[model samples]
Target: MVELNEVFETNTMIRDENLDVRTITMGIGLLDCCDSDVDILCDNIYKKITAVAKDLVKIGDEIGIDYGIPIINKRISVTPISLVGASSCRTRNDFVKIAETLERAACNVGVNFLGGYSALVQKGMSAADRLLIESIPYALANTEHICSSVSLASTKTGIDMDAVKLMGRVIKETAEATKDRDSIGCAKLVVFCNPADDNPFMAGAFHGVTETDTVINVGVSGPGVVKNAISKVKGQNFEVLCETVKKTAFKVTRVGQLVAKEASRRLNVPFGIVDLSLAPTPAIGDSIADIIQEMGVEYVGAPGTTAALAILNDQVKKGGVMASSYVGGLSGAFIPVSEDRSMAYAAEIGALSIDKLEAMTCVCSVGLDMIPIPGDTPAETISGIIADEMAIGMVNQKTTAVRLIPVIGKKAGETVEFGGLLGNSTIMPVNKYGCKDFIDRGGRIPAPIHSFKN
Candidate 1:
């Protein structure tokens, strides 16, 4: 059943094409750690996370060494803290204490990041959820590894304009709280519509209350591999281009399958799913934009860009589904501006604007990711942006998210260096007109007519 040439081809993909497992995330539930006392709650969370994930980093490294796969990150996702700490977190500081405990657990477990500092308020926010949300700025400003998300909209529940307005202010406060580091704290926060639970990615990963207690989800990425495959057929017809992307995605996903099965067997955790997201990096050629360019777009925001991206997204999903036993977690192409070198360059040169990126998100995977606007951008404007993206996801019944940073002290055309996987972002100007009246009239935006199919 084994083939030598296939092995060699995978080796070449890893060595030359930038193929790698982006993350191996372990999702753990904290429901049993809930307590009525804040101190006891913090203690219970720390012990549970540390006990369950003590070997996460070690086993991940061992597996990478044994399989010759470059595992970029080993992380953890827990049940949303708002739910877990509801009885104990009476104030914002109480929630912040839980965040510090999570940061400590992350350090002790040696994880690259720890997610699920979150609250889900798609329909409405509870008292505890509000407290956790209020504490986000302080929590993120103080912690290094903690990542947070808020689910403010879903197709079934529509967009929560109340949460949207609050999140705009929360994002602004987060930027101000961590202004010394180019407002890096906001980079660790994401606002989502219909977010997936088994996502092995940061800033949006959370162990859904409905999910199993412990499971391992692996995220695989290979934009460079996809690009290299289709580049062989440059100027070819659509049929040829699509076939190349599908076959290339199949090969890349099989690597993820192998790693997932092996890691699950060794760790005694359930294999969740393989997320074949084709997430791009700062490295040259390892970019979704490059793949789009090879597919006939002059740049990512060109006239034909959305069509190219749609084709790529559909084909990648088709191929990945064929290769993996189970596939989930935003399994398509991600177009984060800050994380991809070519996309970021496109924004810098005015080839890509936030408006074009929003259009692309209508077809691509997630939305408005890693975009930096000027600090002077109003909270109402940010709320308007969130409302727009959430409306897209609500109407189309697809998952979309925003990870925007109002980098303090930076203006349009200026750059903030985030470094590492986050890369760098050039601030872009927002619309000059104010949307204060629109945001101030905050109430829940009702679900679409299609959502009445009960």
Candidate 2:
């Protein structure tokens, strides 16, 4: 038997300093729930969800208390509702039923968010895909805890111009539906380019068909740990800062492995993968931007920020892979503007803009997360941002996404306070300059010139 202490301890002084696994998500595959009869399909989904996750919340609570760290959320991800509902639903009302059933099931089982209310049309939109996108505003307006996403592009295939245009329209409609409430419905939606199937993160995670049936994936978060590590360094030597981040990441990943093993054991579910992302809340001291600032940058969007993040992301993957046998998902750093206090503060103070955020996304885990734009920004402009972000992932061959909320009636620098985990944000300005020519070009940029390296 391996000694756990020997495995966890090394030259690093940091060893599980108030660390915790943030989420234990049950990825219940609902592909088998596709029956011709809508009612039968609904029943099958409900039964499977309850049966697999009956003791999920209880097990999570026990493990959390035992480890003396709070498990922030218990969640579920199902098969993409588009594919699962396609067989049973012939109309818009049928899609509504699917969304409502998912919402009710999650509330009944005490799951915070039920993901997989999504569609993947990175190549082209199906009739079913069109209907799914059309119903999002209504489904999100009606349901309580259902999240939706649309993956419009992928490196494997290429950009889908038609789907991108459709998603831009869908985003506008979703925002219009929830305009009175800080566009909260838009808050639940994510637009992705190269989204991962096993992502345990919220509002963007869905059960991609490539995933196994009912696996358990963990998302570990601790920007506080990373910031503390950098705070000890009195002066700026970029290399030293990188080493500190690497050593700190090793300890953080070790804690994640222990918590994940414990959670898997108690839930009776096989452990899937650990997402070593430094996810943040609106709370002070928990921001990834704060970690960068502590490393000697004036603010997160400064000149060296992207380079700093590139080193941090690479070092994190290096340490996390050494600590865990299976490390997956967006296992880097996350810098959601509204969700991270320091990032939001930077936007508020005029240190970070959409241009700078674009550059940072190349180095960070996800792109332009939880950013608020003016409600009247042209639909074309929103699509343009998506195209630009997707192009970065396509050229670099990595996962990149966008979750921009066009907060209705809000303008640049205006704060919108969302009183909970949804967080708050000051609306960031989009480029007044148009990308009409580039966006209208409408053809796949033919994978990177470097992708032919083979």
Candidate 3:
């Protein structure tokens, strides 16, 4: 049992340290709502989502009030639309209709964003998957609350070069469609390799086909809290630094554990897991980069940065896992450049670069996350980048994702403001050299030799 007294001690963390629950995501299964009739499918989906998530926002708010834990966003995830709408969807437009329906449900239920406008074709693509992936640009651009993701690779199934190549075009198209909004549609579209079924974070969350009918997963953010703890032991040895991060992570996860349990019990939905990722915000004093800097690195891309990130990520998992009964998702330190001000600044001044960011993802929770690059970045180049990240996740047997917004009409070194938690981004330069030849060799990368463990 968690010491209830420890929960009250978080008042300081909440008030001063920018500690808050990032999101309370309710994952609703929609397989039962699938239908051969497109209209019926859309209706069934909207009805099911609205009915199941009717009280989601209210309950989430109440939990925040009751526990003095500021729950920032209430969101939802559903079964991957490629599978859920397979019986009904024949064309790309049909999938767009479902995306519109999902937007309606999210608006009615008052959630900030609803995920699972997604496809899972890590090995190969079915006709439905192809249609869904093709429709992503329009689906995301037309809907404000709907987010889309496509899984292009996985550990067991190797990399799907076709999907990787396709997503490059899709991402570019999404940017073009939403160019007026600083290519924000691409902000809501992420491509993943080995995505988590119960991730409460956005841009890549989907209710897996393996999940129950309904579930609640919460992602907790406390970068400032951890940073403050580390600051207390300034000039301390490595042993003290690791212990501080671990102990702070334990307390932070307990807070999430308490909130998740309460939300589940109140809504009569099973509690899924607590994702104790030190997800940062645009606010000052709340940055994963700051935590790394505190550890020793002068800047994020400097030497020894990856080692610091590795220590922070591992210690967070070790301590967070022990605090909650079930700990899952991409639980570690998030390094989204846009969301974390320090990271964005690092890129702005050339203290960070795309190549260094790719290397850092080897130790971080998510890969190449929320990075905005030049508008003129070639689609094949984007595919090359995705292929590289997928290769890392494939060989490492871990979840990695890419949310690159090739900001339309924007040049490198320019800034685009997304505001809110999405924050501002300094458009980073992509490699000018073309990768069309490499990307055009369209065949899957086979799974690593060690994947035959079964």
The best candidate in terms of TM-score: 1
lDDT tens readout by residue for model 3, 230-348: 99999999999999999999989988999999999999999999999999999999999899899878988889999999999999999999999999989999999999999999999
Clashes of each: 0, 0, 0
Question: Which of candidates 1 and 3 reaches a greater TM-score?
Answer: 1
Candidate 3, residue 330: the lDDT equals 90
- Give the lowest summed-lDDT range of ten residues in model 1: 425-434
In model 3, pairs of residues that clash are none
Model 3 misses residue 316 by how many Å?
0.5
Model 3 residue 70 distance off true place after TM-score fit, in angstroms: 0.3
lDDT of each: 0.93, 0.83, 0.93
TM for candidate 3 is 0.98
Write candidate 2's Cα lDDT for 377-416 as tens digits. 8878888998889888877788888888998898887899
**How far out, in Å, is residue 358 in model 1?**
0.5
Candidate 1 error regions (>4 Å): none
TM-score for each candidate, following the candidate numbering: 0.99, 0.94, 0.98
Backbone-clash count (model 3): 0
